[model samples]
Target: MSGNWTEQRIPDQRGRIAIVTGGNTGLGFETARMLAGHGATVVLAVRDVEKGRQAAARITGNTAVQLLDLTSLDSIRTAAADLRAAYPRIDLLINNAGVMYTPKLTTADGFELQFGTNHLGHFALTGLLLESLLPVPGSRVVTVSSTAHRINAAIHFDDLLWQRSYSRSGAYGQSKLANLMFTYELQRRLAYHGSTIAVAAHPGVSNTELARNLPGWMRMIVTGLAPLITQKAAIGALPTLRAATDPSILGGEFYGPDGWGEMRGYPKLVTSSAASHDQKIQQQLWAVSEELTGVTFPVK
Candidate 1:
């Protein structure tokens, strides 16, 4: 509700347990660091064990590492099982891992790289861990989307994998859009159970390693204008951290930067594109995601 909400406003997270995907670097690392610093038992769920350990070593609080390669469903399943075994209750699940603007590529499961890793991977992980969250009052699932969701984005049901052809920007937009849709749909499902909630947030234009896959020309352009347009990853992680820890946050809400064009500033409650709020598409994508990942939520 304040115009200047910062990480310091995060209530003491002394007893909460949080799982942050891709916590080894960039926005994920910053998110994990802040949550851990605030007293939450943070798990850095990364694809690289060594990097994860290094990340955990950097944080000075209750933190641990877990291997989680979003590109592989097997890895997701194993990581979820291990987490369930270790923690009886999960207070937060931050779907902070994702790819962007990559060349046409598929995950190990044959889905488009961006869609699979960004949307489906998180979709499956959340479902697998839903039980651990259900019993925990005040639990939350914070999914990281992007402002890119408004750029030529649509859920292509006819070819969800972009099998025929693909545009790097378009595919990335689709994946980010799916992240918001999944959050809204999941929140609707969670409403019936009345314990946990789903929310979404975006970093705006952050200077993070997520841009490594951009094409040469675009990369050059971005690099040239990076100083004026991009915010540091730490600042960018605020929206997500706020969504995860803000006690006043509600289900299905989206958060992002408060600056011009939402390119950079303090975190605030923001509105996504109209299409992203479409309940019909959100529900349809939920069904397709379940069928594709073979991971179904326990929510009725």
Candidate 2:
């Protein structure tokens, strides 16, 4: 497909149902808005119920809010149960929620905050909801990764939780890298089932609250270069929107901006790091994630 893909190209979604995590703000919000506007029933699965409701209110059409605290397995289970009861089938599951460059912190489950939330949380959520997606012929699972996945990133099997020492950037990289690996491995698994598909997309550097956790100096540099380096949240959401809606999109394909260095512009299929394509590492991470999250997919 061309790099000029836009939300205008999204086909009618009259009977589709989309669930976007972190849909309360930023790229997730824009994605949810466009999907709902295109006639899909969208659920803003967010950490904060009130904020999600407010976000839903801002969008027209069939939109609802559901509580989903990715940091907590209990919350994921509850939210998935509710969704299963409400909708037997789901057309799109967008793993758009994530934390970046957070301080050394652990989730309720004691895993590193960034890895736990960005990768493992989505991993568990998708597995728990696999049944709902499998029966839907054209269902998709789109996970939002990042360019940072290539920045000296690895799974860090020895210290997956950053227990020995921590660098915010490194942990964030691991999490994002895991996102890509998960999508690739998931696509492979889904191929056997021959129902749903898995794809990944990255929002080119966007001006969003996700950057609030950056170091002081980095934040200052970003602010100074914002005009040239960052795009609006709506623009940043294009890659994900395309990954979710574009009929030509294939399983395991990744999308990102078309600008220089992929910092900004229209969405197009993009390549991830060599490390991200390592099938052995992807399988290992899949096993680790399942063990860590205690949620296994129905697929082999």
Would you list the clashing residue pairs of candidate 1?
none
Residues forming the 10-long window of minimal summed lDDT in candidate 1: 1-10
Clashes of each: 0, 0
lDDT of 1 by residue, 61-180 (tens): 999999998999999999999999999899999999999999899999999999999999999999999999999999999999999998786898888899998989989999999999
Model 2 misplacement above 4 A? 1-3
Q: What's the TM for model 1?
A: 0.98
In model 2, which range of ten residues has the least summed lDDT? 1-10
Model 1 residue 278 lDDT? 92
Cα lDDT of model 2 by residue, 1-300, tens digit: 444788888889999999999999999999999999999999999999999999999999999889999999999999999999898999999999999999999999999999999999999999999899998988999999999998776889999999999999999999999999999999999999966899999999999999999999999999999999999999999999999988889999999999999999999989999999999999999999999889999998
Candidate models: Cα lDDT each: 0.94, 0.95
